[model samples]
Target: VSDSGLGFSHNRFIALIVSIAFLVVLFEGASELGGGMIKAQVEQTTSKFHPEKNAEDRLKPAMVLATEANIDNSVEETSEAVAAEWSAEGSCQQVIEGNDMLQFNLKEMVVSANCKEVTVTLKHTGAMPANVMGHNWVLTNNTDFMPVAQAGGAAGIENNYVPVGDQRVLAATTIIGGGQETSVTFSIDSLVVGDDYTFFCSFPGHYAIMKGAFKVI
Candidate 1:
C-alpha cells in the first residue's frame, strides 16, 4: 500500500527545510569569501598611496605606519615570517653590531616568545668617535619610525640623538663610539606579535641605512 498522504507531506517539508538551510550556508560562505577578497584589495591599494609618509597629509589620527621615499621601510605583512631572523630561544638578550659604514649586522631581530623582558645591546664596531660615527639602538613601531628618527636628529648629540621622554620610543640605547656597548632593557608585554616594528640608530642620518625589522615571535 502507498504511504499515507500526511507522511509524504511531512517528508517533503523536512526536505524543503534541509534544502533551504543548505542554500543559506552556501550563500554565507560565498559572502565571507568575497568580503575577504575585497578587504585584501583595499589594503593593498591603500599601501601604495603611503598616506602615513607625511604628517600633514593625514586625514585621520591613527597609528602612523608607512614608508617614505628613499627609505627601505617596506615590511612584510603579519602572516609572512622574516626570511632571516636572529633569535636565541632561551635568552632574552640580543646584540646588534653597527659599523662606520652605516649598516647593521642583522637585517632582522627576533624576540623569542618566552621573553617577558628583552635586552638589546648595540655595539659600535668602528674606530670613529661618538660625535662622528656614533650609533644607538632606537625602537619604534614601523610608521612612527621616520618621524621619531627625525626628532631624534633634532634632539642632538647631548641627548644621544633620541627624543627625551618621547612616548613613541619603545626603547632606546645610549649613543656609543667604537668598542663601546650600550643596551636597553624593555618589557615586551605591550608589543604585539607579528606586528611591524623598526630598530635603528637615531644618530643624524644613520637611521636611513641602519634600520632593520624588529620581530616578536
Candidate 2:
C-alpha cells in the first residue's frame, strides 16, 4: 500500500509540469499573433495620413501645378504680343481747318503711327462767336463718335461743349469761334492701326455735318 501511494504522487507531479508547459506555449503564440495584428493596424493608419504613399495621389498635385503654370504663361505672352503690336510706330504731324459754314476743310485726315507727337491746329475762319457757331476738334473710335457727340452737347458751351472726364474722347481741342484758333497735341502711341477712328466738331449741332474719318497709317 505505501509503494502504490508514492507512485501515484510522482505521476501527478509529472502531469502538472506538462500541463504548465503547454499553457506557456499557447500564451506565447497568442502574444505573437496580437503583436502582428497591431503592427498591421499601425501601418494602415499611417498610410491614410500620407497621400504620397499612393502613386496616383503623389502625381495628381504635380500635374495640377504644371497645368496652372502653363495657363498663366500663355496669358502673359498673349498680353505682351498685343501691347507690342499696338505701339509699333516711330513719329509724325498734321493740321486741320474749320470755317463758319460748319465744315472742316478735309473730309479725311491721315496720321502716321510712327509719329512720336502729333499737333493738330484748328483755324476757325468763321465770323460767329463760340456760342453761335462753336467748333471743337474731337477724336474717338467711329462707333463712339455719335454717342460722345451727343453727350458733349449736353455738357454745354461753358465746358467747351466737350464731356468732362470722358475717356471715350481720345483727343480734343477747346471750342473756338470765327477768326480764332485752337490746337491739341497727342502721342502717336495712343493710336491703333486698322481701328476706325473719327474726328468731329462736338459743338451741339455741328457734329452732324462737321465730322470726317481719321486714319492711322
The TM-score values for the models, in the order shown, are 0.60, 0.57
The candidate that wins on TM-score is 1
Report the C-alpha lDDT of model 2 over 58-120, residue by residue, as the tens digit.
788999999789756754675465335443242244567788877777666666776777778
Quantify all predictions' global Cα lDDT against the true fold: 0.83, 0.82
Q: Which regions of candidate 2 are displaced past 4 Å? A: 1-91
Off by over 4 Å in 1: 1-88
lDDT of 1 at 164: 92
How many pairs of residues in model 1 come into backbone collision?
A: 1
Best by lDDT: 1
Candidate 1 CA-lDDT value: 0.83
**All models, RMSD in angstroms:** 20.9, 19.1
